[model samples]
Target: MPPPPRRRGSSRGKILDLIRTTGPISRVELAEMTGLTQATISTSVRELLRDGLVSETGRGESTGGKPRTSLEINPAARLGIGLHIGRDYTTYIVADLAGTVVGRLRVAGVGDSEPESAITRMAEDIEQLLDGLDVDRGAIVGVGIATPGPLDRDAGAIMGAPALGAWTGFPLAATLSEATGFTCTFDNDATAAAIGEFWLGATGGYNTYASVYMGAGIGVGIVIDGTIYHGKQANVGELGHITVDAMGPTCACGNVGCVELYAGPQAVIDAAHEAVEHGELDMEFTGRITADFDRIADLALNGDATASAIFARSAEYLAAGIVSMVNLIDVQLVVLAGSAFQTIGSLYARTIAQRLGERAFARAVQTVDVRMSVNGTDAAALGAATLVLQDRLSPRSLASITLA
Candidate 1:
């Protein structure tokens, strides 16, 4: 919490950022990279070194000149904590300054506990994690919480959720802060995944894309030119509620035939179990929704008719949803990441690509790219960590620009 050396409007930010991306670089190389004079680069490097954010790696061979000192980011100088609260389990990760996940821990979820009790347990776990890792408390920049949403992020409260409404109207971030003694921030899981992708994963250089987060439910986080779009109260991208089948079942959101009713892994598992009960499905899958779906998807890939049809039905509905989404938003890229996508992701991706090719409004003029996240099931948690980084280094006041 100590005041960071003047960041905004300071050449040090730019210089430090460049060194991180293009390092073991020399002062001359940094100057060449930033178009800053050698003296300006020296001044910024001095500030960065004094702040302990940058360190000199051993000297490197020169290009027909004297050996030069190499510069690099001091990743271990600080840490960020990211937590993902979900129905299956909760994940907590600690990332260093350079976005490396240096440690992680998972524990039983809230179960039937109330929101206050659940958050209290999470706080304890975070304390244990830090203590076990022996991380300096001052080195922890802050904590970021990612959870299922319809959140009032600005107010740091949960609005609604799927089976998900245990904490509506609770001041989550503030309450957690009071308990843990660390500043806490919150974002819907889908949006957190997008920010994670923006900061530490694939979409770092890309300005616009959509990340579809499928866990117990489905949601999309939209980023345009490096800024996540948060409509009036941060309830913006509830993509699962889109009606893909007008004649399908009614949804809890008071909508008929919403895509999640068919494509959410829980929905598909329910459908699969129903098929099993009727003896239409040759195999039975039971366990966590994600595991059951993974088994079912494996059967489908192995050419079982029932399993294939089950995933196909889900994929068709998902395709309908994605096509509708791409048609409306026109983002050239859509990234699939979450616990659900860990299995059957390729099926969804292939089907979605095919759907976009055939049904997207501008298919003839443009192509939409569907990708799987490299961050995998950890995307939300990792992105949650990225939120702490973003808040500390790249404030919204510097919008529409690359984050630090």
Candidate 2:
């Protein structure tokens, strides 16, 4: 049997993508924007119109002789799904081709659950959410799953996640595809969050950038030349496990004095709990660590010396990690994301910016921009959705799949 023919880019696809991103444009304008002839643009636009992907909304003002028709993408033409899997919860959302979320479902965490059980529950939840929506299932192009590292991108299995125990080596993408009967894409949560910011957040137009995700652990995703740089094994950006202090503390990844051990949410909670046990502060530490971090951030914001000191220590470790990243990658911007960053974001921003300005290798050449992610809690999930959109609509940059 002969191999199936390769799928190449079609003129219609290119024109449609242009209209989707920068639309309400006339045929002549599209030709000028894409460097295609007027006849080619007209034919592509006509095909898009016939497929219900583009529509003529109105008439544009005449540039020379007659008015031209304005073309725009029909956002209702297709849909995509994004799923963010964290230790505490699983977030599911449906978005249109334009990246507008139409539905959302947040399920309570699946802590310590076996991989199969957790994925089964997640698949059911996704099905229920999709069934409730009025849109046709055919409109859903694919699903994106974002989780912590280290991951085997080709095998679609999580190598090991500190928070999500018993998930290591599970065939996540294959299992989900079997259950849902739709193509699935899996990526590191931080990478997904970074790309999410580029597609839907405020980090656009920046050439080089880093997205720092602080959850149960720390992860960094780097973007250069508008493309994510995943090194060999798709785990190049494991910034959390980098050794910061040779004698600081033992990390879950078996490394001594890693940054995550000193600055992750667990570290903060451990410090707070120790303080509470020693008659320092009257507070509960047995509950959720994130809530505890939020409390600490609130107290610090309100001028509590103990809380302020704790956050300062955390920020210092985070700054050291940022300095290492800047020196190595030479990124121009760093964005903070996840719940932990949201709590003490301003402190992190100030501390990292100051340290980078003083110590970065490229400080004399270019200023490194550092700030918190505008997407906040929704970054990972939204980025997951973008994976689907890219797979279905934007094919040039999609990650190639390797079967097991």
Count of clashing pairs, candidate 2:
0
Clashing pairs in 2: none
* Shift in Å, residue 122, candidate 1: 0.6
Off by over 4 Å in 2: 1-17, 31-47, 400-404
Cα lDDT listed for each candidate:
0.80, 0.80
How close is every model to the real structure, measured as TM-score? 0.86, 0.89
TM-score of candidate 2 against the unseen true structure: 0.89
Tell me the RMSD of model 1 versus the true structure.
Answer: 4.3
How big is the RMSD of model 2? Answer: 3.9
lDDT of 1 by residue, 1-404 (tens): 87334324346666766776667899998888778899999998998898788899989876788889999988887788999988777899998777788878888766557988888898999988887886677778889899887788768887767655777788889999999998887788898888787666476545678999988889898887656776655676788899977888889888998999988888888888888899888775656666687788888888888888888888888888888887777787899999878877898899998989999999999788889988889989988886776566544321232443
Off by over 4 Å in 1: 1-17, 25-45, 58-70, 246-248, 282-287, 397-401
What's model 1's lDDT at 258? 92
Of candidate 2, the 10-residue stretch with the lowest lDDT total is: 395-404
For model 1, where is the 10-residue window of minimal lDDT?
Answer: 395-404
